[model samples]
Target: MAVEQNSLIENYSIVIVNVAVAVIHYQDQYLLGFRAASQHQGNRYEFVGGKIDAHETATQALIREVSEETGIDIANNIAVKLGRLHHDYGDKRVCLQVYRIEVTAQQYQQYKNLSQGLEGQKLTWVEKQKLLAGDYDLPAANKTILAWLQLPTQISITYPLEHFNNASNPMTVWVQYHQEHLQIGALVYIRIKETGTEESINQLLHLRNDIKAIIPYNFYTEKADNTVINRQIVARHLTQAQLMQCSNGIAKNDIPDFIIASSLPLVVSCHDKESIDAANQLAKACLKHQLAPVIGIFLAPVEYTQTHPDTSPLGWEAWSRLAELADIPVIGLGGLSPVMSDQAMLHGGVAVAGIRQFFK
Candidate 1:
């Protein structure tokens, strides 16, 4: 079994262990068990499995847990190892060894009789079609099982905000897969408006020299002077769709670790309350879907409006609450001098994002 340690604040360490999970499907319906309320993730739907006890091999543990939980005596020869799953539950982690098992009619009947009136565990057979409909709130480990069971599809990539908007450094994005580093793919979407100027776009191209293909921003403007601005805005909107489509297209494609919307404040005025509200809603929805985390960048103006109330920079409290509810990481942007990174972290952000401050 592989061991992984995840470090959290205050010296807390999360430990993950590897074990095996068995899937017994009959007529396209997979067997599942509801965990007892007393168990760590009580009441959640999970595959039939448990931690491998001392001196026991993975196969032995799988056999023992299946018998203990489902009362099914699976013949050793009938169990087939499928693959492995790595899961982290904040406090602990588990690498699941997956297996597919076959059960005969006679064995099912005998197991049914033995499992009757069992305490804490509720067993059921769920159709694969219904399972794919996303009806149940399953544990992370179970989700890995389902992914393995499903047909192979394109990889999905998601680019969150934190990766790109480093205040002190010119914008850059990191990509990852299964928490491992990966290079960007050929087709990349660059938001022209977010890049602001042709020079900036060229600079970005230089930074991502490895990329051979890029979908440039096409502006929409009736006037000559505003052509660039229009194109940028159009590019921004298109980039959003491109990012989403890329994320849903291939699971193997490395998800961008961050997206740099702009080094400057994208919203020129705080008075656009509707835009702020819409952004918040979108962020919330993404979080609900387990999409990438969002970081709001607040590039401060050179001068402050004396008439405005003395509010914390960028209404930090409001954004912090929204991110917290969605379990999304938020990094404060704008006027984030190097010294303020600590303060931003204290305010529930992973870190501060800034060009001047980041490089400094």
Candidate 2:
């Protein structure tokens, strides 16, 4: 027993060993495995790993698991321990030891076939921004893993447009990224919300030439309308499939970028909690796509404080949390005046988004 223990701990000065894990990166995305539906925490994305086998070293376990799941074998010389995480799940406690592994293109290609359903699992490569956007449900343990793997890398393209007096005038823009010019196959989307006017919709459609596709919100019934509401009108009017195909066009390109989903707010009877939650969710989703920064027009209610004094303040907190979680800029919309712009950012926003303030 003493000799066996000495063998496991031979090279290590530290006596205690922790369960080890590995984070695999490909094209600025981390490889994650989806836990299939089971009695345990299934349907959540998790790092590919398992408990270290008895008498086996963490490095040995990592190499084995990587080979099992990804088919790409890591040279023992290349595997390096990045960090470790200690966390407690509801049912079980785990100490996840993490490593950083680098692989060559040839090795990746060779292992691609063997990388399927290792330990009977599904896998995916998710970009850091998408991971932060929180679209897919992740296990609690994986969240900690993600926070540690957050590398400082520029993975987004930003296009800043100069405002023109004539909406029809081609908007001069600067696309900022390491790449000089966008590839031919890159797809962009131009989206607009209905402001109860056909002219606005037409103006947005005209901008479609600059983008690969356009999506317009067309199905909205006024509260005063006693007639049956047609939800399908929005679906029918929008070219969703075309938009999706355009969005997917990036796969063929060496590097892909997108711009989609603009926002325009119309006056409604109430700014309820549900509406605020939905808006928060949408904002997070948009940031995940790294779409053009949204410009929202907040139509203030006639009697703002009377109906939603309590709820109005909560929106700031919700927006703050979303910004923190998603690490994306948000421009506050409702009741924002020039005087309040600075305060809004301090609370949690990029700038004020309102027709009166922004248009001027």
Candidate 3:
């Protein structure tokens, strides 16, 4: 009996890399599966997934799980890996690899007849509001996974307009350099000055042309009022002063869906708890206005930054705690670069954001 107990202990000691979960979204609703009463944590609701086999990759496991549990077969390249969650449940540890399953409108309609493919389990679609309201109970381990689902994988902020006078030559060189080395999908930000001379505007126009030549990528201006070329808007913080500044010229109705038929995400920055709280409140307000909620919340000063070395940082531990409270995806800014992307993701940041790293 002692030897058997030891064997069981050894089994638990080994890390479990078998499980994969899916954050299946159709429109604004998330597809969730209810567990059977006979299973562990029975009757509780969670994302649909199953254990991976030795021969299968993480993506393969998710494809199989979706088909087996939901009677839906996702096409290849439809699912994007969000990240992974490693949690210890006393008996065993699970590394839950999460993926975001995106489908076209027609493809989604084709799966309308999808049902609960597994016996003793049921399926339902929950809207974002209901899910955020905490109406449906979920396992504690899923708290982090839910947060990860809302995060952007990577983000790049460009230097302000002052950095380049001839936007074509330098900007073209910059794009070519990045394309050859690091092929990353990032939401690029082109920092435009609020008040610019006619020459600067023309230069920006030329720069915009240079960016568009790449095709199949997204870029936006930093200045809120410069909406002529600003495809997406970013509200730095929710302080009354900053909020008023960010919303000064823009109408309330012009947000969330500023551009029709495009997924424009609003990025908001937060430095401390007060701003984070205000950001959440602002998100709720946007929801009320039917505007897109804050998609990225950047918490800064995780480490002492070269930009602001005098200011004390929140450090990694505190930043992680605050990140978990954010209702939207949070990115770690200040003293971070693309090299720290994995560390940022591990410590609750959806992506690593920096001004000097990517810009300089």
Candidate 4:
């Protein structure tokens, strides 16, 4: 946790605007507004929110903003912090205090009946698939918000693909785990560690919305169709090495084929600041192409693991420091459990991922 944040606002001569933003939601639908052509971020759709006042907390500001924008009051709705995003738009910089508001059935209906914003903006409920497809023109600044919306608080990754090959029914345990997690609204990532096993890829693809698929770079490069994306599965998973290949920039060099064809967000595995920097560069490159950016990275080995007894764990303090370097979301991996989600978020991560604890 950072006790003090040294800002360049004074040095850079930029006016920083602090605003409270919300992603109002109900099940798979999100409340959005189609901005008038005359307004800022004109003609593009945006989440419902407003600027915060000096005396108001982010939550208070959001509640007031929601009430002002729409007739419904969200005083009792659960608003989870998806983390903050600060953008420098050259003229002025805006620091967004973004939150996710999970609305109930009646609230969703109330908003649905309200055809237009109280201020004359058009209101609509867009499905998750449409948002994933970039069907609506959202400000590029909201790229990370899109990533946060796509990610789950708890991620369940399957054991190595080859480990299940010997079993008569390779998908048996996976199916069981998928069902269990699905019941709880959690997601499953079927990791493909082996190259020659193409059948596993097909089986994983068949998962559709059942299990949000996340495949390794090699597997995606070889078998991912990309012709039509379901928007449910994560686009691709970049290993640290694969990510390093484009360290210079995705501009002059050939952007990876997977990235070029992707309509879905990407996931990267990062450890140190160097890898995180690489992922950040990749994300900026994706944003330029109107492609979904690196939604999050799996920052690993926060604690000692039997898999790698020799290597030292990051522990909590060092892990938090590493997480601070990543502007995007971070999922703490390696020797962690679901119970540690709050600890991970408190330290700058969005969630924790592991096979043992999640599967158990």
Provide the lDDT at 286 for model 1. Answer: 33
Deviation from truth (RMSD, Å), model 2: 17.5
Query: TM-score winner among the candidates?
Result: 4
Candidate 1 segments whose C-alpha is farther than 4 A from its true place:
1-14, 112-120, 152-360
Compute the lDDT for candidate 2: 0.41
- Pairs clashing in candidate 4? none
Q: Name the regions of candidate 3 deviating beyond 4 angstroms.
A: 1-116, 119-152, 160-186, 192-194, 197-241, 244-265
Lowest lDDT block of 10, candidate 1:
262-271
lDDT of each: 0.45, 0.41, 0.58, 0.72
Q: Candidate 4, which segments miss by more than 4 Å at Cα?
A: 1-20, 26-34, 49-97, 101-137, 161-186, 204-209, 221-233, 250-254
Going through the candidates in the order shown, the clash numbers are 23, 1, 1, 0
> How do the residues 1-360 of candidate 2 rate in per-residue lDDT, one tens digit apiece?
000121233245423325667776654666777887883578787777766777666778787877777666774435434334434454554555565555566655554444345566777766767876776687665554443343211111112222222344423322122023432322222223324433332333233222222124443332233222221111111232322343334333311222243332211111234333333333333333443322221222212332235544435655554433222233344544445655554554434433233211
Tens digits of per-residue lDDT for model 4 on 65-166?
988887768888766666556666666667676777878898887666666988877888888888867888887577668767778778877776445567
| Model 2 bad stretches (over 4 Å) | 1-18, 111-115, 153-360
Q: Sort by lDDT, best first.
A: 4, 3, 1, 2
Which ten-residue region of model 4 has the weakest summed lDDT? 1-10
What are the RMSDs of all candidates, in order? 18.7, 17.5, 13.8, 5.4
Q: Sorted on TM-score, highest at the top, how do the candidates line up?
A: 4, 3, 1, 2
lDDT of 1 by residue, 1-360 (tens): 222222223345555566667887655766778777887788787778877765676668777888777767775435544444445566666666666666777765555433332444777877788875666667855653453344211111223334456644433333212113313432223323333345444444345454321223232222455433333221122233333343432234343332232211111111223433434444333333454323232222212322222644445555454333321223344444446544554444433433322221
- Who is ahead in lDDT, 3 or 4? 4
